[model samples]
Target: MTSLPARLYRALALGWLASKAVVLLVNAVTFPRLHPSRPSLRPRVSLLVPARNEARALPHTLPGLLAQGADEVIVLDDESTDGTGIVAGCLGAQVIRGEPRPDGWYGKPWACQQLWRAASGDVLVFVDADVIWQPGALDAVLHGLEHTGADLLSVQPRQRPVTVGERLLTPLVDNAVLSYFPYPLIGLPQPAASMANGQVMALRRRALEEAGGFAAVRQVVLDDTEFARHLKARGRRLAVALGGPLIGVRMYASYPQSVAGYAKNVLPLHLGSRPLLLLSAVAHLAVYTLPWLVRVPGWRVLRVAGLLERVAANVISGRTRPADLLEGLLGPLTPLLALPVYARALRRTVSWKGRTYPQKAR
Candidate 1:
């Protein structure tokens, strides 16, 4: 007979799994997805890329942006040691030297503020330098913004994780969004339901100005979500969508880079509360790991449910890689691998792109 404590744990695990299953069911239909649209009624667009030591990445990503038919393409070389500015200029983008980030400002937000000031377009598209903009990507995003009547549209570009470590960890990023967020609430005008992806975001210039622009989130490392929340709080229209083949990003090249990259955002995701972070780690281990290892009640059922949820998440999020479905089966291992990330995020500071920022819950 199962002991009382064991039975209780089983109940909790099964309950959590069931909750995620329900979320997946809802998001399957309601989640917005983007596909390439024919350019029409074109608004003046300023394509902005914030690059830091991204000389190598610019060669692959910048060409796509330049070909997007934007009124102007601008790349801010954020004091990169690697000839980021020169490469962007050669690629036919108007390169701007970013001013040094002021005290109490995070690097990306500071760089973005400079880009925002320089842009003279009805639509402001902020894209990371590492993203690959497939043909018609910008048009589709703009169409999404206009169709939804949103002031800001944040897109989760399809992830292309090639390495073993990347395959293991990267798919989980979409899982968090696809399996948790209440999709219906996302459309409602409320800050609590807001979400955003910094990988690719398109904003109307007027909406950005009303929301106080990038300066509103200058200090926080998780600038995207905070900025989205700020916009939503001020009654700005917001939308989140999946970028199918139209946009792609390989955010980290190796296992270690993936670990460090995730660590920087993990604490911020938990709102910088040590107790909350600790609780999350323990909950993930219990909810994700124990269901696979122990032959407890409903263990096999839980495993199958978890895998299906993962695969469904991939499909719903527009991840087209065949490997992603296989990686979905490896979803249970993500919590175990993310243990190191959780540990690193517990520190007082985190580093990214040669800059270290003090971590604090705002």
Candidate 2:
């Protein structure tokens, strides 16, 4: 017979697992899918790319983007020392020289602002430097926007985690979304439920201008999320979609790079609260790591729940390859791997792409 305290602990863990399972089910059923649909009225589209030290990636990505029937493809060379501008020009992208970051402005927002100013299209599409645009991706994105009548349509690119380290960390991105928040809430009039993926965001040119453009989120590290929330607060219709077969991105090449990239955003996720960050780390370990290592009562049930959640996340994100399934099986150990990322985020300053910024406080 279990002691009362042990029984209470088991009940709480089970409850947490149950709540997460419900969220996953909601996401699996309600999350929007991006598919190619021709609009009745064709809007001129501008594909915008912000490049910094991305000369190597341009060759692989630009050609596909150019193939998309856009009015123009523009690339802002964000002060890259690696001839990013030259590469974009050679690849047939209209390259714009990015200006220096203004006071209290982050690099990405500044670059995006310049791109917005230079763009001449009714539909403004922002693609990150690393995103790989698949066939019919632009058409699918336009379809989603028109069908949903969304002021801003943000699509989550299917992650291609080629490296071992990438496999270990990338699944958590989908997990963070599908596990914590129900997808339906995003369609409701709730600003707090707002979420966005900067990798592939499409907006109406007028909607963007009405929201004060990228200048509104100039200082935010997580500019995509903040901007989405900003639009939501003003009663703008927002649509979230899975990129599926149309879009993909490989964010980092190795484990060390993954760690550094994740660290830059971890603290921001917690709103820069030290106490909240520590608490989240402990909660993750308790729920995800402990069951694998400790043979406490009901550990098997907890382990099964964690595995099922991981598998569900993989399926929803279109990670059905055998290799991807294996990575999903190892998702339980990501909490242990993330401990180092949390530690790095706890530092006063974090660096990315040759720039360092002080961590924002809540």
Candidate 3:
């Protein structure tokens, strides 16, 4: 027999699911797509990639950018122990050695600052080494920027989670961008409504300048988020689109790598405050794990709705697979699976790609 607390939990979970479902459905109808643009006046685009020990990904990613007909493809080799510069040079990219990291500057923003200075195009595209772009993605991004009149544009790529660990965690968070935030507000005149994915960001040169540029945000971990906020602060538009078929990002290679990769970014961002973090953990557990608390077929309505909401959100976002759709129904297991990551974040030490960034408690 189901207890009183269990019954009450399911009811509350249903309400949360219903709200998220409404968000997913509403954003799907309103969010813009990035198709080809044929505007008469097109800005000159320079593709810049900041790479640190990314030799494994360069060969596959470079060709995709080269095929885009971009005016230039420049790669900043940020003191890689691997022959990243040589690999970029061999692949026909204009390779530049990134300057040493300044005392307070983070590695990525420092690399990006150098790349932006070197780029001569009116438009600058910062692509992550691991992100793969389709043949005409650049044109579509240019089109999206022009159509929305956004000073900065970012397309959250279709996340391909091949590993078992990824199938469990990836799809759930994938829904975050569209599931919670209002699509129209992202471009409106409010920093509160802005968001961006660092993997593939395109910005107008003037907009970056007016927004205080990469150097201004050099020490920040949430670089893309700050970019969106700054751009919106300058009264410039910022657009975020779903890049389903046009782009794909392979986030991690294995389960262990996935844990580290996610914890480094996720923990600090969500768990910065002790009270908020504790409240968030409990809320996540109460809602997501609520379905797991009871396994009866009759009371599975809340679980079913939660699962379907995730599936519908992913499908609407344009990154759904048949397996992932079914796998995502187990969405309730996410917060539980992510417990270790949450714990690691609290420890104040995070590692990524051979670099260690110690988190300073707020």
Candidate 4:
């Protein structure tokens, strides 16, 4: 016989599944498909890469970027001790020395602020140094923006997962993003629904300035999401797409590094609300672990619930099997992994790239 709590949990799980199914259906019906043959009519674009101790990855990433037919590429080396500027410069990108970061600024935003000021192009493309662009990637993004008349176009760069830990964590991150934002609905000019990826973002210069540029979100730990919110608030049209063949990113070299990387932003996600952080952690556990818990009843029921959860998570994340299953198993543990991150975030201080920033309360 099913206990009351187990039955209640099952009921909650069913409700969650139904809600997600509706979202999936809506997304399927509304998502816009990119037409590859369409040509972009926009003016030239400037590709800006902000680098801090990214020398190891720049060599591979820069060449891929250079091959993308952008008008110019500017690399802002933000006091990197690893000779990132020299490497980027040697690869044919114009290198600029980033100004000293002000108190309210984070590393990438500080560099981006300088790059935006220096760029002369009508369109500005901010790309992380860790991303590798494929051929026609730049053109596709430009075309998508021109066709949609969107002020900003961001792409979800495909991430390369080389290790077991990466495979587990990557899907969890992707699922969290998709579940939170539901991309298809986001592009429909709604303020309440908006999302963007920091890996590769393309914005019109005028639109960026109109949205208060980087200065508006300088103090924000989650700059990408904050910028998207600001743009929506300003009524600037925005669209996002999966980067199909356009770009790829290798976020971390090892498990510990990946955990630390996520910690850097996960806490500030709550804007310092401990309750919200705890709630988020609990919700994550429910979504990722409930299927497994349901399995304790019997193999047949467990198999069915596991399959349903996997399908739901897969649709949300756009990731494949085996990997998704692995990530699902690991998702419940994210709260534990996030504990130190939340503590640091609560303390309003986080260290990244060998530099620390005191968190400013929202």
Candidate 5:
């Protein structure tokens, strides 16, 4: 017989699994479908890309951005030693030199501020240099913005995890995003509930200005989420959508790279609260990893949890594989893999592109 404490634990785990299942089911049913309708007001759009040593990836990605049919495309070179600026200009982008790194400001934000100054468009679309846009992406984004009447719309581009490490980490990263903001609840009048992906974002010029533009979030590590929060606080409407067939970004080429990328933002996410970080890590481990370790009364609960997590991953990632869901069986290992990244995030002051910023400084 299971002890009272064990029984309670089982109940909690089962409850968590059920909640995940419900969220997955709801997302599957409610994720917005793309019905292409061009905006009546086709605001002139400026496409802004921040490039730093992205020469290898830019050639593959810049052409796609150029083909998106925007009014103007600008690539801001952030002191890249690589030929990012030259390659971008060759691909028909108007390249601009980013200002020198200023204290108390993140690199990407600085590049964005420069792009804003150089741009002359009513709508501004910020895309990372690594993002590959599919045809009709710009059209779809404008359509979504007009349809929702939102000041800002951020599309969680489909992630292509080509490596073993990426496949393992992708689901966890995607799950964290999905768990934070449910798709259906976006546009609700709650300031604390908005979410965004920095991979691709579209914003009305006036709304960007009203939210104090990129300057408002200059010091933020997770500038995308912070920008959304700023818009929400200003009572500007915000929307998030999956960029199905419209965009994709390969975030990291290898496991170590992926871990480093995550470390940059994980600590900053908790807003420097060590206790909150610990609590969140524990809760994530419980919901995402503990099921496989505990011996529940039946395989039914385990199977259900596995299936639900897969469904959630598929919906969030916009890719379906029987193998993908089966992969949830390996979810117990996620915490172990993420632990080192979390530790590094907590202990180290990360230096990116020759500048050092302590994790605790914020």
Candidate 6:
């Protein structure tokens, strides 16, 4: 009636906040800058970008990449209907026209696999086409790799939201991983505790080949997360740090684009288990939405706690748009909104870049 026991929200809320604190701490320490002075002997770096109709995005990202310390840059145009291949070539990148997607392989993994095979550098940097690297980003990436001794490192890009849909859903980007999983655990060589953002991932050539590369996760929709797990299984060290300041990606341009993307990936994030899906849906909705029911006693406390969590998460994520923060904190229907998206995602066959994968892609 009035309120679910404070026991309910307090338990999940405290756990959520505590993990956020850990995420912030780890990110603050681990996010390296382009070493004030460059290293004496940095490994030859190869920048690999997987493009699918990325003509619009390549202009923003490719120029920054070309200026990096990497010895070579390659772009795999994954059967783009647009001028992705032409654009990539004109930008001075060695453009590799992507082959048709093989059966049982996802588009991104296939393209990345192709790029990895052709790469000439000791270190392979896989950047999403949408990502725009700030100056010194490549140096910072190398710094992170050298300092951590990590075989695989993923830099979660800072989100730049131009649309309302992005502002609301992008929290799930960090919140999804950072809230449930601790960064320390993710850093360990444990298959069960692993995370990575495919947008800006780096892998040592030897380790990547040794671990079977994208071929290991050819069928996974959550390609990056699964890639990190595969590397962990091979006993390779894993490291993930903040890349918001180092790079930015506007993940979704419009509401439909945002919804469609999430629909394909979000539900399966729980491993296609309906019960876990339902449970998460209920819990998330209750925490943010139910507390807004002011008729309930002590409701303001619950509301405040939920808002604070969002604010802190936004701050840590480096999304400082006051309007976005205010809208995110005050708009408590995210989970309720998310429920239909996930449900629709579950029901529909997932399609991207003119190819379709099964609803629960293996």
Pick by TM-score: which candidate is best? 2
Q: After superposition, how far is residue 13 of candidate 1 from its true place, in Å?
A: 0.8
Tens digits of per-residue lDDT, candidate 5, 1-362, equal 77887677667767766776676666666666444456777889999998899999998898888997889999999999989889888888999988897887888888888888889989999999878887778888899989888888888777777767776665566676665446777767786677888888898999887666699888877788888888888888888777766787888888788787887888867877767777777866765565566655544565566546755666656766666655665666777778777777776586565666667734
Q: What is the model-wide C-alpha lDDT for candidate 3?
A: 0.79
Candidate 1, residue 362: how far the Cα is off, in Å: 8.7
Tell me model 2's lDDT, rounded to 2 decimals: 0.88
Off by over 4 Å in 6: 1-37
lDDT of 4: 0.73
The parts of candidate 1 lying over 4 Å away from their true place are: none
TM per prediction: 0.96, 0.97, 0.92, 0.87, 0.91, 0.90
Off by over 4 Å in 4: 1-4, 28-35, 187-190, 290-347, 360-362
Residue 103 C-alpha lDDT in model 4: 84
Model 5, poorest ten-residue lDDT window? Answer: 294-303
Q: Write the per-residue lDDT of candidate 4 for residues 1-362, one digit (tens) a residue.
A: 88988777666656665565566555545554333543547587899999999999999899989887788899999999999999999999999998998887877888889999999889999999988787888878888888878888888775667787666454455555544455666766666577778888899999988776799888776788788878998889888876654676788877667766876777666666667877766765565454455563343443354355544655543556565545555544554555555555566677788987775554
25-54 per-residue lDDT for model 2 (tens digits): 888998987776777787999999999999
lDDT of candidate 1 over 1-362, digit per residue (tens): 98998889878888888888888888888888888785457799999999999998999889998888999999999999999999999989999999988888899999999999999999999999999988888889888988888898999888888788787776678888888887788777778788999999999999988877788899989899999999988889889888888888989888888889998999988877988999999988777677788876777877787677778888887765677778777768878888899988998899999999998954
- Write candidate 6's Cα lDDT for 117-168 as tens digits: 8899999999999888878888888888888889988887777877676676
Tens-digit per-residue lDDT, 284-362, candidate 3: 7866675579663334676677667778877876765677677766678777887876776677666777877777566
Range of the 10 consecutive residues with the lowest summed lDDT in candidate 6: 31-40
- Using lDDT as the measure, which candidate wins? 2
| lDDT for 105 (candidate 3) | 88
User: Candidate 4, clashing residue pairs?
Assistant: 348-359
Ordered from best to worst TM-score, the candidate numbers read 2, 1, 3, 5, 6, 4
